[model samples]
Target: MICYIYDGSFDGLLTAVYESYYMQEKPEQILRKEHFLPDFFIEPIYIKTSKEKAYKVYNAIKDKVSHEALKYVFYVFLSELKESSTLIYRYLKIAFKIGKDINLHMHNGIVLSVHKISNKVTNEVHRMLGFIRFKFLASNLYYAAMEPDHNILQLIMPHFSKRFSSQNFIIHDRKREIAALYNKEKWVIVDMLKADGEKLFLNNNDEVYEKLWKQYFSSITIENRKNRKLQKSYMPERYWKFLTEML
Candidate 1:
């Protein structure tokens, strides 16, 4: 069995795919460096990420495959599902063979798997878009923190960046240990693995806003019309921790 190991970036995954096709050796599994387990029987090949190689593969997908196929590839990558690397490799293999109609071939296992994972990622993005609540910080920034199941910070940043273009903000993904920092002019993602959440500078007026919001939420709640199950279905319990009213 052959295992291809790479850095955890999407570009690195594409580079691994490029190497596999170039070497004419298909790997049984493609794993990130942290996930690769050593085995005497399995041949492990470490793949270095190359921008040129990754760009080539990306261009091929864009030029040869349909735009929808490229979109699916990105969405599936963002899904962060187990064995997503191998799934993407297999999906691309079949995609290149079957042409632009590959997505239409739902009977194909790889195609179906990619489609399902992409749906999961899309759902998570939509949920985050609705669930995210920002708090005014003492630093004059709007800050929000969340621990989404998938790596969707990048996917959802554009929405907030556009809506709050005039203000500076930070969207911290606790699970991923990363933060999307947006200034009034532009935005950038930063590694915040060691960031102290407790040190977040909250505005003095935040408490007043929180109290007012919670009171408004309580006033609007209809005791007779309350449906816990339905509410949970719409807004998962996990997200309530970051919501001001839920707090």
Candidate 2:
């Protein structure tokens, strides 16, 4: 069984998909290198990231599945699942062989696995819409930082861009170590290793806003009826670190 390892980028995943299809030999499993190699006898194929091949694979999928299906694949990739690459390959192979209705194969093992990953990433995408707090930076650029469990900056960009069309901003994902920067007219992403952000007001430092937010939070909590477990389930403790209301 062939074992494929990727750099864990969407383009990289796409390139790997392109190679797998061209090679006509589907692998036993696809894994990210963050985890150590399994005890099994492994034949490794290191997936090289190439935008050209990536775009070709994208067109191949778009030829079979609707654009919406591609979006679902994007969300699934954000989940960073170890088996995501293989599952996407499986999904695409079936999709291309069959027609558009092939999406009905959602119940298939690979398709279902991909949906699970998409669901998790989609949930995080929704939460970051509300939980993220933007700080005013010099040059009129409003900025916020988060260490989201999923790679969701792109998912979160359009919402803010459409709503705040006149503003310039940046949303950094400290975990994935990338940031999306919007300059009022267009949006672009950059890695933090190349960023110019300093330790300046990285967290919103308004005392009054913090106090008012805290008061509102306390006021809203029904002490006697509070279900801490339910609250924690919805808003995990890890996410609270970057939320102003929680701070």
Q: Rate the local accuracy (lDDT) of all candidates.
A: 0.87, 0.77
Off by over 4 Å in 2: 24-26, 33-40, 137-140, 193-198, 202-206, 218-226
Candidate 1 yields a Cα-based lDDT of 0.87
Q: Per-candidate TM vs. native?
A: 0.95, 0.83
**Ten-residue segment with the worst summed lDDT in candidate 1?**
196-205
What does candidate 1's lDDT look like per residue over 1-247, in tens digits?
9999999899999999899988766798998787788999889988999999999999989888888988898888777776888898998998889888888999988899899999999998999998898877777877889999889999999999999999999899988889999988788999876365446852335566678889999999999999989989999999999888887
Top candidate by TM-score: 1
lDDT of 2: 0.77
Tens-digit lDDT track of model 2 for 1-247: 7877878778888888888867766677666667438656778888888999999878867776777678778887777766676777777777777757666787787767777788889888898888887767555668778888877888899998997899988888877778888888999888874244545455445556557777998889887998879878888888887776777
lDDT at residue 151 of model 2 (Cα atoms): 77
Q: Which segments of model 1 are wrong by more than 4 Å?
A: 202-205
